[model samples]
Target: HMTNLAESMEADLKVHQKPSPVIVRDALGIFLSILFWSNHRPVQLDNLTEQIKTLEMKPLNLEERLEYVLKRGNTFLGFRQLNELVLEQRKLIAKR
Candidate 1:
């Protein structure tokens, strides 16, 4: 669940305060996209998840991964979540 990932991310933020939050936020976004897409369109979900899992095994940068997700992510909900997370991340960085 995204919430579970968020909770873990919260802890990671406290420890690796430099880059953890956005990385975890991006990860949560990926997870949400996967679960939502899977529930809605299983075929597409299967293909995309396979690709993402492969990328997970390597050194794909977050920006590149996010761009890929932006292409595959197919709902207002996912986009909204991405926007919110990015905004919230920016606000946090601004405070630092």
Candidate 2:
């Protein structure tokens, strides 16, 4: 499923400058779902207000993905963290 998702995202990118929110959401959702099924928590998060939360979908390069997993991927990473990571990934590509 992941392979297929990745492939579909790649195809979308070939047509546009970025991937759609649906793609990112699906990918992340699948990843988190898998993580939940595993013995790990996937990510971590502290207190936060829902009003301050937001979600962004963006295309990801290999480097950004690695950085995200290394820098932000934690057991507490929730929707907000994922959204931030997506925005960061978009910024990284835009700057290039």
Please tell me which predicted candidate would have the highest TM-score against the true structure: 2
Question: Which stretches of candidate 1 lie above 4 Å from their native place?
Answer: 17-39, 43-65, 68-96
lDDT of 2: 0.45
TM-score of 1: 0.29
On residues 1-96, what C-alpha lDDT tens digit does candidate 1 reach at each position? 555555455454456433344555565555545433433433233454455454322222434545554553333343344545444444544554
Worst 10 residues of 1 by lDDT: 54-63
Q: 66-93, model 2: which lDDT tens digit per residue? A: 3454443332333334545445554644
Candidate 2: count the clashes: 8
Candidate 2 wrong stretches, greater than 4 Å: 40-96
Per-model TM-score on C-alpha atoms: 0.29, 0.40
Report the Cα lDDT for residue 93, model 1: 40
In candidate 2 the C-alpha lDDT for residue 72 amounts to: 39
